[model samples]
Target: MAGITRRKRRSTTRPAAAPVTPVADLIRRDFTAPAPGLRMVGDITCLPTFEGWLYLATVIDLHTREIVGHAMAEHMRTDLVCDAIDLAAARGFINDDAVFHSDRGVQYTSGQFRAALAEQKIRASVGRVGSCYDNAVAEAFFATLKTEIGATIWRTRSQARQDVFTYLHYYNHTRLHSTIGHNTPAETRTNHYHQASAA
Candidate 1:
């Protein structure tokens, strides 16, 4: 018999990556804040297009349910999430020591994202693994968005981007939210600030 060897099959699965540092479940299923810029949640979603998928990262204010920051791109890389956070921060929507909660996505758990949060003086909060309830608010937001957008697919990414831009504006300034007593997110924020100043 001639000596022969068979090749070993390589494993296709990869291990789950842990967070760079210990982060707590700060939100703890209580997706509420006494005021704006105190607690926030963020998540990423994809839009279908003939050109390809358009990825969107959004930072939502917990109190008002407003998408204070967002970024869209063709890739769901760490930079995409960071850019979202940067936008939120640059707009002065995030306050120092504000808790930003997200699911345990790779981009959210990456060191680069942690550094970005640190740079903005925002504390990082992560939901429990495999628990959709842990991040329900952000999850629900996407569900509402896709349902309201009423588009199965777009002709191009550019078209998708434009529509998303239009949608975000409507969501923030026009759409009524039952969570905030049927007030728009912008209205909720403004009302809170106006009441605070008057008091």
Candidate 2:
């Protein structure tokens, strides 16, 4: 008979570090009712695909609940968020004292991402770790996206990109939000501006 050897399994225990309290403070400081272009919420979410999961980073204006900017990337790097921020800035979303709020994900805390905000005079607010309630608005938008778009496994990144873009256009200009009184984001913003002018 041949000799058999056995190997010992190693424990997967890890050290527990002190809780990060700054994240909670940041969330509390940033959470507020929406004012046009003054506050924005952002987050990244994953979508399944046959090739791999697609990551989407989105920035939405809390006033109209409009997804003002977004980016899709194969990697959830800082650049993914930077791209969204750049898009929002290009669309004139960045004004003095604007605040960009997101979870304490490393991507959001990266130097490059922070630098961009600093350059635009925008403040960065990070939500507490493991607390999704801090970013509930962004999460709710993602849920609405998944529900209305109908999840599908993408065969390629390009396909996912196209589908996401199409859905975003519809989301901004067509899909009605109950919170905004069943008005699309675009419509809500327009109506707001018109009412302000009339008043």
Candidate 3:
């Protein structure tokens, strides 16, 4: 210990409230769907700025690995997650048999989000705590986002939001994903719909 520099200590606990009814890990790392909008995974990530932390909540279509909905806010409240879910539902991303999966973050477990899911007829699926694999696709998306966005420290929340907005548009429209066969998420989705319509 004479000259060794120890790494800074960080808390391992995820910054979210506990579940109300102890939801089950319905996803169980499947992270797949034969069709678009059938299975969706949602998660929250933090964007740092001098003004404060901007929490970005996102709902991703597991079939195409596309961000179906996103909401950026100053706080990670239940409303934030609800807004993202509502957007996805309004855009017809949640089919009749679709399942919306997430970790049991306090926001996801809140009564508001539960009611929102009921309103959209979407089943709520949750994963066990500390199991990233259960929501791996969402986790991977955030990682890719930060990596591609350069992870720069922003001056304000609006600045970070704008950057994320542009990047998400590019992500859905242009950026190719190896997981989805090196095709853009939008392309994958469009191809599916076009083929279905053609048949």
Candidate 4:
């Protein structure tokens, strides 16, 4: 006790840091439609399987929030996007004046993809590089698909493919979107056509 000195230790606890918010300037602005059928958005998202990854490409009608067409493949190539576009055209959702918007991904900017759009007489619009908001709706859909239906890992590609097909059907038929007044895309499109006819 004669020469004992006790020093108190500092507390190890530290205050939690504030959550990071993306800078407003860094956030990309959403594209506005010039006219119906004049603007569309497209994107690709990957689904994981125990065996491998499955890629999904989609073309959505901005006016109706309807997925005009989509395609899934074992690989993400120019053909994936082109095949979706072809399906959309076959469904009569695309026109010569349609403006196709997508992020500046290589698959979209590749010569083969450009050629496909050009052959259809559709104009290509590229979003700013590395900006997710520029294609926010498409991103949102992918997020929803992953959260609501897609599994993190499937036992096989066949299972993943079946699940993807089922999810797409529900997405196009049953998913209610707040942006479209809580209506499914198909219902919204039908209502829009009805209103247009009445007008």
- Using TM-score as the measure, the top candidate is 1
In terms of lDDT, model 1 sits at 0.87
Error of 2 at 124 (Å): 0.8
Model 4 regions more than 4 Å off:
1-28, 31-36
The runs of at least 3 residues in candidate 3 whose Cα sits more than 4 Å from the true structure, single-residue gaps closed, are 1-20
Q: What is the TM-score of each candidate against the true structure?
A: 0.91, 0.83, 0.89, 0.81
Q: lDDT tens string, model 1, 1-199?
A: 1112322322211223965577899999999999999999998888777687788899999999999999999988889999999999999999999999988888888899999999999999998877879989988888888778777577788888888899999999999999999999999999999999999
TM-score of 1: 0.91
For model 4, how does the per-residue alpha-carbon lDDT over 130-186 read when each residue is reduced to its tens digit?
Answer: 667787878878878767873666767788778878887888799898887898878
Which pairs clash (backbone N, Cα, C closer than 3 Å) in model 2? none
Off by over 4 Å in 1: 1-16
Residue pairs with backbone atoms closer than 3 Å in model 3 (clashes): none
Q: For residues 11-47, what per-residue lDDT tens digits would candidate 3 score against the true structure? A: 2226357656666666778888999988999998887
lDDT of 2 at 66: 84
User: 1-199, model 2: which lDDT tens digit per residue?
Assistant: 1112322322111222343323223447344445567888898887666676678999998878888889998877789889998899899865677888987677776677878888878888876767778788888888777666754566677777887898899998998888889999889888877998999
lDDT of 3 at 190: 94
lDDT for predicted candidate 3 compared with the true structure? 0.82
RMSD to the hidden true structure, all candidates: 10.4, 9.7, 5.4, 14.6
